[model samples]
Target: MAAANHNTVKYGIIGVGMMGREHLINLYHLRGEGVAVVAIADPHIPSQQLALELAQSFNWPLKIFSGHQELLNSGLCDVVIVSTPNMTHYQVLMDIINHPKPHHVLVEKPLCTTVAHCKEVVNAARKRPDILVQVGLEYRYMPPVAKLFEIVKEGSLGQVKMVAIREHRFPFLVKVNNWNRFNENTGGTLVEKCCHFFDLMRLFVGANPVRVMASGAIDVNHKNEIYDGRVPDIIDNAYVIVEFENGSRGMLDLCMFAEGSKNEQEISVVGEIGKGEAFVPESIVRFGTRVAGRDAVQTLKADDDRIKYDGLHHGSSYLEHLNFLSAIRTKGEKAPAVDLQDGLISVAMGVAAQLSIEKGRFVTIEETMAEHKF
Candidate 1:
């Protein structure tokens, strides 16, 4: 309700589902940082109950609301975490941006299901200087990934030429009403799940994408499981190729059925002088130059001592909250680590890749943005 201060920074969470609960717990761990989850809004009784139980464990007295508007009306929060379903992000974000009260936001990734909605959110947020909006592209905060970023920035991986990321993980979990099973809701597998990788690709290359080409389908998961007599159309696996404006290229190899893999994600960045690789779960980073050879490559375990909570995202979400809280306390002196443009471009890359798959051709980022009229 009041301005961001050194005092307790109150928070409200909309859509207390899986990711919403993650934010709740993250804020809980940051209680010593003057953070608290003061309120939560979720229409689903089950999700509400689960979040309430979590709040009770944290000894937080929450004012529960069935909808976000009610939570905003109560003036109980200085910041809000929007963890709603994908399709709903557009409207929920618009409402938050339009609300008179300033509520800094950390919306979960994808920004919105469509590029047009993301553009509108970007424009709307630009008007609200009082409100700081940070998209939850938490993968950037992962210890291993963050380490790779440092190496790249330090010029350890000189003149980056290619970046490749492989995610061999299980299928998407069942969300409220199984809404994630369709392309219309989740923005297809590329935008829905691979946006994280796309974001990482952009950072590793340090350039904007120029075009994308992809091939994927619903080949592995949710084939026989039908929801309301309609089978899922969302692709479960894909190989996406992104061409950047700097002539650096990126590739994504995704497989939802490879649950047997040791590491959930493995990323490699190859430049002119050296190459660096990071592995999630394994939490490892390796770097080597041509002169050093593969045998001489050094390996180290990636870890952030500042991370107090290691949640579902390998402590990235916790790290993200730490950064967001610091930025908030600065009172806009510091900007969000991942801004709206990063979110928009990540979605655009995914959208281009998705379109590429549908049309069986390379989709230029220019062409994709032109269609959105942004």
Candidate 2:
């Protein structure tokens, strides 16, 4: 990667929602180090005003616009963070990739709503080799996950044989109730929420999933409607199976309406020599084997040292932003940690898992790609 051109790395945010607000705070810190957020655009006036207030607090001149096109055409930003809803990722990404600005794009998770749209954004990025397109799978940037990848690749765990994950949380009815309740906007429960876990599964195994099968039901949320000849269309609880190209297998259990259930985004990877588990929020990794081939498990503790940050998380959004900026300076020769292609595959896996559940059969990632005509 080329050296970061800090002075020239200006960013514009296209969405001012929750993730957008986080990015704005990240850019605020970046601005103190010569990089800046020059423009912001969102459909909601309240969002725009919030962004302006945040920017103004830093005494930075941030221009706010009503639409993304205005922000792009203003030439105030060299990169655009497309943090809009999943349905709009395709259009907004295409606009950024096609613009004369050819600005680098940092899109939020899952890339797009469907495989076809994922392909569209990726193909456009491929055509413009000068601009970089990165997907925000922030978990990949987390320190614990990074360490997990290193340990797996370093053979500390020996050949990873099986991976299992559980993500159970309360229904997401509090925010965007209608859009999330239905599959029309959210792209089914698995794709809407669990793509991040899918991405991590791929990353930990260091292989793409070749096949997937899943079973799920709207047992708690929207169950009555689904049983009454009305399709709830969204899954609330699911059991997913994934087989990797290298013969490793994974099982995932996801539930959205489990009573008294806490958010469980934990993964356990069983390997030939040992097993490893990651507790995401706590940033803890436990690895070790049983005593002398006994059935008991052990925990290999990490150093537990923390890295210093300049007003950013150790797994900082600003660091990811800096990485994107570096990729742009390198003219696509430098690989982004999470690129458009990775984003597509992540979404594809989610799509396949959902399809497997709905069709009551195994689904190949290839079949999902074929449906997209890719």
lDDT of each: 0.93, 0.77
Highest lDDT: which candidate? 1
Name the weakest run of 10 consecutive residues (lDDT summed) in model 1.
Answer: 1-10
- Model 2, 1-374: lDDT tens per residue? 22156455778899887668778887776654456778888888877788888888978788888899999898878778988877778888888888887677888887998998898788788788778778888766665666677778888788888989887767765332244556767777788788888888888787999999999887877655533345567878899999999999988898887646443567788888878787655567777764345345444433223322323234446667767766776677788889777899989999998888878899999999885432
lDDT of 2 at 362: 95
Each model's backbone clash number: 0, 1
All predictions: root-mean-square deviation over Cα?
1.4, 3.9
- Candidate 2, position 25, lDDT: 83
> Residues 125-214, candidate 1, lDDT per residue (tens digit)?
999999999999999999999999999999987999999999999999999999999999999889999889999999999999999999
